[model samples]
Target: MSTDKEDLVVDDDFPITEEDVEPRIEPAKTNLSKRRTIDNLLEERRLQRQLADFDYDL
Candidate 1:
């Protein structure tokens, strides 16, 4: 069952069925490439910082 709300409009000829009135999950991954690039950059910076800190600690 869908948790989405639908508008209650009075239609005398409206047909109701399980498949007819159901919302489906869209198989979409929006902005994944951009997100991955940002994540990789952040991870690389973290590794570089860690290496620098290790050299200073020694």
Candidate 2:
């Protein structure tokens, strides 16, 4: 669902042009593209294994 809001008004002589409306902008990415270190990958794998372990109380 989009959270953007736009107003719709009915006008006979309304001059519609591209300059009147704001340009659609893409969200900027915060993280830069960089090669991952070996230690970082190993920690990620450890976390994934931890989450995969399931314990039932039944």
RMSD of each: 12.2, 14.9
Residue range 1-58, candidate 1, lDDT tens digits:
9899998888799778888866865545646766888999999999999887785644
Cand. 2 Cα-lDDT:
0.70
The best candidate by TM-score is 1
Q: lDDT (CA) for every model shown? A: 0.81, 0.70
* Clashes found in each candidate (C-alpha, N, C closer than 3 A): 0, 0
Error of 1 at 12 (Å): 32
**Candidate 1: residue 40 lDDT (0-100):** 100
Tens-digit lDDT track of model 2 for 1-58 = 9788988787789788999999876544422222345568888999988878846554
lDDT for residue 52 in candidate 2, whole number 0-100: 80
Q: How much is 57 displaced in model 2, in angstroms?
A: 4.7
In model 2, the clashing pairs are: none
The all-Cα superposition gives candidate 2 an RMSD in Å to the true structure of 14.9
Worst 10 residues of 1 by lDDT: 24-33
Candidate 2 worst ten-residue window by lDDT: 27-36
